[model samples]
Target: MSELGLPLSEQSLQQAHNGSREEVMRVFDEQHFGRHHAKRSVAQLEEELQKAYKNFILANEYKSSKLCEALYTRCEDKMDQLQVLRLPSMAKFNAGFLLCNRSFEEECVGPSKTIYEQRMKKMLGKSRSLFIKEYNHRLFNWLVAFSLVMVVMGRFVIKFILLEIGAWVLFIFLETYTRMFWSAESLYYNPGWHFIVAIWETLVYSPIIDLDRWAILIGVMLVILVLYWRCYGRRKHGGSWLLPLYRNHEGGSNRWRSD
Candidate 1:
């Protein structure tokens, strides 16, 4: 047995092959749970296992059919043990190995493809959940800050408009940065990132005003209309400021008008 407690060399593997199944299993147990093995970190163990697996594959590439079959079985069994160890990195590595080596005749392509797909799905789900949680937290904080700014400087119309434009630009930059940072592995694309990019392009590059600017313009118009109405009504009527503009003021009585 090598330092890792597994038969990694051709001579060692041949010796293990001659030995009984119980002996082979005993070696596997030692590699997995032996006292000396406990001193090594999980990362060390995984690295060793990965190296040994590659060596085994290379060594058995042109060997006899029977020997290749035997070594392949050992390799598969070792990977299964690694799975039981619950190391996600190793599990992903194993899945990739299986998928990549599906032409080895030891396993069917269907099963390897299925395992790879399952692993990818799980990884995508985890990434998406984390991305959403982080995004919501950041968005909530941003909205709170924006609200406070509006409350504090709402009387300064020009400054408020500039702030709105700045806020929109900053929001887009941060959102794009966040999406790109969270979208893992170039091999797989996140659907959320694509969707966000599509919407952004459509909104920003359109002939009409961008959505954020349009919203700001509409809001400013509404504020102006309300102010005009209040001032005009106050000047036209001598009634109390708190009274409605439609209140009857034909005589000296403050009453509702039918019209």
Candidate 2:
């Protein structure tokens, strides 16, 4: 028996090598349960058995270790044989095979194509969700910072506008430079750039008095939202809808709840 009380004797190793996977697993469970008395689960026992089997194979010189190596070699051979058997038919292959073949692009080609599309869609959805989440967080921080700057420069409207315009120009320059340096695709499809452009255009075209009024309105609304969030929203729902564009995994906007 090994230190973990696993039966690693020559006889037990032979039984494990010759028997089915389940039978060997059952033996491992029995030995582990006998010593530990259900302190470990079946999965834990199986994992431990795998670890012991690996150690046994690594020992290399012992009879039981040789048997363990032989068992692994046999399992690998069986897997290779199964793979070889599957090579003849396209239908027997995996999603990757179907995806790589351009001929399979026709609709209702096979279940593999459908499975591949579903997997790709799921992967893209998760990636888009993560991108949106990060974008929202960055945008929120930017908004708060700009709002604070607006408050500090509120009385001096022209100075604030000049500062903001400069900032926007710098941002655009950096974005363009980075995209060019990396040979990245056009920013036309990017929502963040779209938002930035929309805001910049609004700022550029709007009247000075109108801009000041809008700024004051936004600041007041932000203050009221922050106060409400601190007093009630945080304690109640553990969430905030301060960013309306923010979406949950279900693609639904978070809404303020009434008590």
Candidate 3:
């Protein structure tokens, strides 16, 4: 990682240099050579100054660029490690945000406020767009989740839950018939393998679900879907119920608030 870090550092430094070079040249040409001198005549001298400054930095070998590269590598390592962990995704996201902010400030913001503002604005705009895009994604996810809930309820409970012991006996007879003729697995398949495993692990270690739990699960999901839909609709149109409504202390209604 350290070996790789050096070249990454060099590239970032080069980018930093490139971004500021024209601005630096403009200022140097104006101040050093004065406005009376022709701008085209100073191009060679400007290139010399840029090369000298870069070479001097390399010769002196400052650690800021290297530190930025190390920080980036560490952040990448953390992300890769977190992918294997069961920790909450939000926590991982926050950690990543912190890492970027740290690296950005350390590497780029030290030069000038103008540079910092441009970098920060670009970073923040990208983040805001990403957040909105993810919000839209979660709405679709909620619809899928609700549909899955309905499918599970219809398949397991509505179809099989009311069957009596007589039905079981019939199923056994059919099983015997099928085993003799067809030579295949049982007809009544359990779709919830993970849920069954969870129940078993709970009893041995927490409680398992039986046949009667589907209705209650469906009800809970319905309530969740309603809440999610309400929130999602509000957010899509620039309102949010999750955020508390406070009387504007700034002495204004919606328009004033926007301003």
Candidate 4:
């Protein structure tokens, strides 16, 4: 797509050249739009644009004018004029929010930078963050509604034996996913499932299975092993691959270095 500097087939290129606003909106997701509090940032907007363009191509398995229209429609204003384009969440965040370098309006306009800036200011408020907040708030509310629907459907789907088997598999997956998810941010607030697994192992697989205190000792040893590995890796590797620190200094420092 032109916005994202992606290559398109001849047919796709032709469609983009003549694509309608609605065609573009359907492909736009939350990340394609800026953060709720930071819409004015061009970098965020462009990142979203590039992501939208790629996702659109991928999702449709090719370009269709119809798909493009749907993408455009997502970002269109209440008056039916295209406001800001949307990007899929995957596309949006992968493009990196904080790394965005263009103005919000500039990113939205894409190739037509000057025209979009003039039109955008005329149509929307100037505060990028305010625009982002409102957009994201609306999106968040939509997600909550969608989640409720899925929960209801999930309950229905879990009633049968086949579905129950599927559900059990899903439950296992959810456990693994939840552990990874919660452990990434706040392990304390996370439910004790991981610890429960640890405890279960300690009780079942250790001393009981071995008929000695070795299991208890093994659990303690495993904990120490993990702790040591983490500490050692951080100190020796000088990379944040395993123990990824959400560092404010890294973001700010990178920006400062560029300046």
**Candidate 2 per-residue lDDT over residues 153-254, each given as its tens digit:** 432422335455555554555456446766323443467656754674355234343333265677799878866865786569655434332223674455
The digit string of per-residue lDDT tens for model 3 on 189-211 reads: 32432343343334322123322
lDDT of model 1 at residue 7? 20
Candidate 4: residue 102 lDDT (0-100): 31
RMSD of model 1 against the true structure = 21.0
Score each candidate by Cα lDDT.
0.46, 0.45, 0.46, 0.41
Arrange candidates by TM-score, highest first: which order? 3, 1, 4, 2
- Candidate 4 lDDT tens digits, 155-245: 4522223433444554554445547776322432335534533443354333224312254676588668656755685468555344323
Report how far off residue 136 is in candidate 3 (Å).
2.6
Better of 2 and 3 by lDDT: 3
TM-score for model 2?
Answer: 0.19
Clashes of each: 0, 0, 2, 35
Largest TM-score belongs to which candidate? 3
Pick out the ten consecutive residues of candidate 3 with the lowest summed lDDT.
204-213
lDDT (Cα, 0-100) at 95 in candidate 2: 26
Off by over 4 Å in 1: 1-112, 157-259
Looking at model 2, residue 3 earns an lDDT score of: 32
- What TM-score number comes out for model 4? 0.20
lDDT of 2: 0.45
